[model samples]
Target: MRVPTLQTSRQTLDAISTRQAEQARLQNRIASGLRVQSPGDDPAAAAQAELARSRLAHIAQDQRATQLAASVLTTADGALAQGTDLLQAARETLVAAGNGGYNLVDRQALALQLRNTREQLLKLANSGDGAGGYVFGGQGSPVAPLTGTMTPTYDPAAGTQRVGENADYEATVDGEAVFMNIPQGNGVFATSSAPANTGTGWIGAGSVVDAARLTGHDYAVTIGGTAAAPTYTVTDTTAGTAVASNVTFSDGAVIEIDGQRVQIHGKPAPGDSFGLAPAGRQSVFATLDQAIALLEGNPTNAAYNQGLERVHASLDRALDGVVLARAHVGEALRGVDAGSASNQQETLSVTTRRSGLEDLDLAEAISQLQNSQVATEAALRTYASTARKSLFDLLG
Candidate 1:
């Protein structure tokens, strides 16, 4: 393909041009530390390297999301821990109110202490993440999730905000379940005494004796017969049927019916009645409110004992709920940590693949670059020498 007019010179020039281009390409690769500069260099390796890079980008994005979720969950855990402490303080105050030596002034003071605890707990329930959003705000809320100073209603959406749209973990714990749906009794069933009864009797917070026989129905235990020969009867109040009748009773005897059992203490009047109902959700606010009311009432010793027992049981359950929510947050935190580790592992693997596909082999690249430089210099020298020979020998 040489031109007839200057075939020898043109051929020499073309040889130098090609050698120089190859030398320049090798130099750029060595300097850039990338062997595959373009698809033209190695199409298959280029495509695989691009895929690896895309995966790395996604992994980075996921890691960022995991970090954000961990932060929110950590905030939620701290808020719940503080709430548990507040509830513990309230329990102590409640116990103090039950003291017989404490007179009206003392009980009132104790009630005020409980009121303060309620206020503080309400604030904690509406805790924020320092980003103008609530830790207990559930999915989202324009206002505080738990409102109403007196009752403290849970008004937020039911679902918790998650780390991601499809993430199995929650960034925030379920505040409604923690604060508004606390179990009232021993986490199974609750018991109560009839207000009209004038007896020294008290009912214990009962547990399910047999799961297979659980009726999940309310029952009424009534004292019957003469005062000297008192007997107790169990009736299924929910189903309107007798569960047990004419059962012998003594002081603090355990009574069982429908797979549930409770011990009654003290002497119950012949007509005195006690009620047992399946455990139901009671708002933490209402539980505190009840304690405040009990102290504020300055009731008789008998009433104080029974009412305080109920409040104590309720508050304990409230505390348990908060602790449980805290545990859940801890679980989510662990999950986030696990996710971060997974992301790091994937990032490393992808980076290695991309390095294999496109990263320069420094020693080998340097060697190739040196060879190309030699080749380019040799071609240039040869072209100059040939040009000199052809001009001198042109006369020949």
Candidate 2:
């Protein structure tokens, strides 16, 4: 009987201790405001919370990357905008120089202004991002890509940065594309009348009306016959040798040779030659230098007119390059904004999911904690009463 009594007491003590532990756990949950403190409490919910947290961390990292990309693109865009304005100023100067009334003094003044403009462009080309790297530097060259006023040198390689998951962006504009790579005229061929031509002969802007027929070679139209029966012949001077010989010429004649159509106007004197060559790449810096030289050279009226036309063509191409760079920058900015929006939405969803898995309901938790406290107190009181009542007391 005594053994059974002792066993019952021991069972009552174990019950009280278990109830006390339950009460303490409830209190901890209420204080911490987390229902699932460990995976042991709710394995599935804990795993879900961990996954959400991991996704949120990734989102944060990508958001930072997007912000960095946006900053670089913004800087590049601003630089390109300033470059456009500088080109416009150069164009305006060229126009002023083109005026018939402008004399040597006026031309010199314009050249000085152009020199200043070129300096500004160079500065823009070598702009930095306030960091160790250059804004326009393609791959972080050891030195500036464009230097020297008379003959600038550009040597750069392409470089890119990351903005999002599997999304890499070009933050640096291709300086070579902007400064050195420009198709001369019509992206095919360029035409120019000889400066020594005394006749009223003029070469209109030639076009690559046909690509297949074009030999991609330079040609010259030389006048040989008398003025009464003036004859023009097309010669491919690719290797100082004539490919097409003795082609007939007439006033206002449209001649198609090597896939290009060129219109000839006015008369051509003996030995007068008009040139045609494949449109090739030329640097904007070199173009500016050449323009300055032409303005200072004080060539004859006809020569000056021809030089002005060439300058206009080069300026147009450079402007196009600047516009293209700006467009690319705009696209990058839009992408960053879209990515930012996506990241925000993802962060919201993750936070909501994690909250669902881990957040506690204060009202429900408080009610359960109170109930557990009552049970714990009841168990303790019963155990105390049972312990006090010994065998002798029970028998009496």
Each candidate's TM vs. the true structure? 0.92, 0.85
After superposition, candidate 2 runs with Cα above 4 Å error: 1-4, 43-48, 193-205, 208-215, 236-267, 390-396
Candidate 1 achieves a global lDDT of 0.84
The Cα error of candidate 1 at residue 49, in Å, is 1.6
- Against the reference, the lDDT scores of all candidates come to 0.84, 0.80
Q: Pick out the ten consecutive residues of candidate 2 with the lowest summed lDDT.
A: 160-169
Candidate 2 lDDT by residue in tens digits, 110-202:
999989988999988888766566677776665776767677887667554444665655556677887778777555788898777887676
For model 1, where is the 10-residue window of minimal lDDT? 1-10
Error of 2 at 118 (Å): 0.6
Estimate the overall C-alpha local distance difference test score of candidate 2.
0.80
Root-mean-square deviation (CA) per prediction: 2.8, 3.5
- The C-alpha stretches of model 1 lying farther than 4 A from their native spots are 1-5, 165-168, 390-396
lDDT of 1 by residue, 158-269 (tens): 7787764247456666778989988887777889889988778888777778888887898999999878888999999999999899898898788988788798888888
